[model samples]
Target: MGMSAGYELARRGFKTLLIDAFDPPHPNGSHHGEPRLIRHAYHGGEAYVRLALRADERWLELEAAAGEKLLERAGVLNMSDPDVYTFDGRLDDALKLGVRLEMLDVPEIVKRWPGVRLPDTYRAMYEPDAGYLYSERCVAAYKKLALKAGAELVTNTFVTDVKAENSIVSVRTKDDTFLAGHVVLSAGAWFKTLEPFIKLPIRAVRKSVAWFEPRGTLFDAGTFPGFTLGTKAGGYYGFPNIAGAGVKLGRHDTGVEWTPGEPFEPFGAYPEDEGYLRRTLETFLPDSAGKLLNGAACKYELTPDDNFIIDTHPHHSNVILAGGFSGHGFKFASVVGEIAADLIERRVSDQDLRLFSVARFAVAR
Candidate 1:
């Protein structure tokens, strides 16, 4: 988010300076994972769908600007029991938004992807245009663009303090202090570090994802599609094997609460890290449930309601806050950056950002 926002601000002729705790595209942050799903027929609501559509357009523009491929149109398959609200919500959004969605029965799902083994009662929604994004590459692209657009980047610097007063925004590091007319706080999991200035209820949760060796081409990207499955255990999402990267999988719910400054435990820290993914794969994608290639652990900055916080500080309107993405925010980075720049420059956005206001939460003060 910070990289994208920095790029937008710099390109738009703002004297922008981006500070990062570590060189981006590193494993420490949530954006390190190789693939992030991008679905337009959103289960969340119309607001998300609108933002997603705009984001899709922006990603293409970025790709053109960078002269590299950052998004893959591998398509996405959403599988769930008929009674699951997630499935209903996605279908409802598709119908109302005119998104191209194909409702698939168990037979069609099996016929289309022989590897996916769902129960007879399960249904599937296939979005042919939805796909996955190359997360690290997207960050790198934005970083390069930001620099080319004349933005100064300070990497591997920890921001110790942030203050907004008298229409001036002050950001301090251990070595130096800088002041500007406005500040965009996009600290990700470390967002709580600024709680003293911008009070909000947020926490960092440790989550794990893994890649499994597939049995054959059945789960390859050309044949299979990116998928989300709802089962008795929980919601699981995955990407098909792309360029022999293996089948990537992760659980969408339930992660350990982690402190902001502590070392994040690796993927095998808990038995369920691999165990749960293995079980989920065995049940839904039996063919792709081969040996485990590798795993990674990242953080999710979650709000109480799992919605994003994209509003300015309650008292300090110049300090824009963008975090608490929960787990599903990577695809929106492009538009979020635009919105951040919009708020900073115009103090308003054409997009309806009321859904992500800081006022929605009972702030901690």
Candidate 2:
């Protein structure tokens, strides 16, 4: 979010400076994993549909400008037991926005992807236009573009303090301090450090993802699509094997509490890291659960409601606050950057941002 916002602010002729604790595209934050799902048919709410459509346009534009592939049109399949899945808003939003979605029965799902083995009670929704984004590459692309657009980037530095008073925003590190007319605080899990400036009810949670060697080409990207499955056990999401990277899988709900400054434990530090994923794979995608290829751990900054916070400070309006994205925010990086720029420049965004306001949280101070 910081990288995207920096690029937009710089390209729009605003003197911009982006500060980070570590070099981006690194594994310290949530955007490090290889691929992030990008689906337009949102189960969260209808408000996200328009932002997602705009983000898709911006991502394609970035791909064209960078001369590289940042997004893959592999499609996305969402499957669940009829009794467990209750988010009908996904279909409603898709239909209203003219998104190409197909409702698939058990037989149709099995016929299309022979590798999948779901029970007769399972149903699926397929979005032909949805896909995944190359997360690290997207950050690198934005970093390059932001620099080329004359934005100064200070990497490998920690911001110790941020003070906004008398219409001037001051950011301080261990060695020096910088001042700007406005500032965007898009810190991911490290948001707790800035509580002195403004308080928000956010917590960091540790999550893990693993890649498994597939049995055959049945789970390859060409034949299979990115998918999400929900059952009585838990919710899981995965990607088909791409360029021999293996089938990537991750659980969406339930994670251990993580501290902001502590080093993230390795993927196998806990048994459930691999155990739960293997169990999920065996139940739904047995063909792709041959062997564990690789694993990674990341952090999710979650709000009380698992929604995002994209609003200006309650008292210090010049200090924009954007965090608490939960687990689903990478695909919206492009438009969120644009909205941040809009907020700084015009004090308003073209999109309806009431859903992400700081006022929504009772604990926000």
Best by lDDT: 2
What lDDT tens digits, residue by residue, belong to model 1 across residues 1-365?
99999999999999999999999878887987799999899866888888999999999999999999999999999998766534677578767877889989999999989888888999888999999999999999999999999999998999999987799998999999999998899999998787688777888899999999999799998788899988777888999999888999999899999988887799899999999999999988998889999899998888988889999888888888899885899999999999999999999987888889888887644
lDDT per model vs. reference: 0.90, 0.92
Candidate maximizing TM-score: 2
Can you give the TM-score per candidate against the true fold?
Answer: 0.98, 0.98
* Stretches of candidate 2 exceeding 4 Å from the true structure: none
Model 2 gets an lDDT of 0.92
Model 2 lDDT, residue 178, Cα: 98
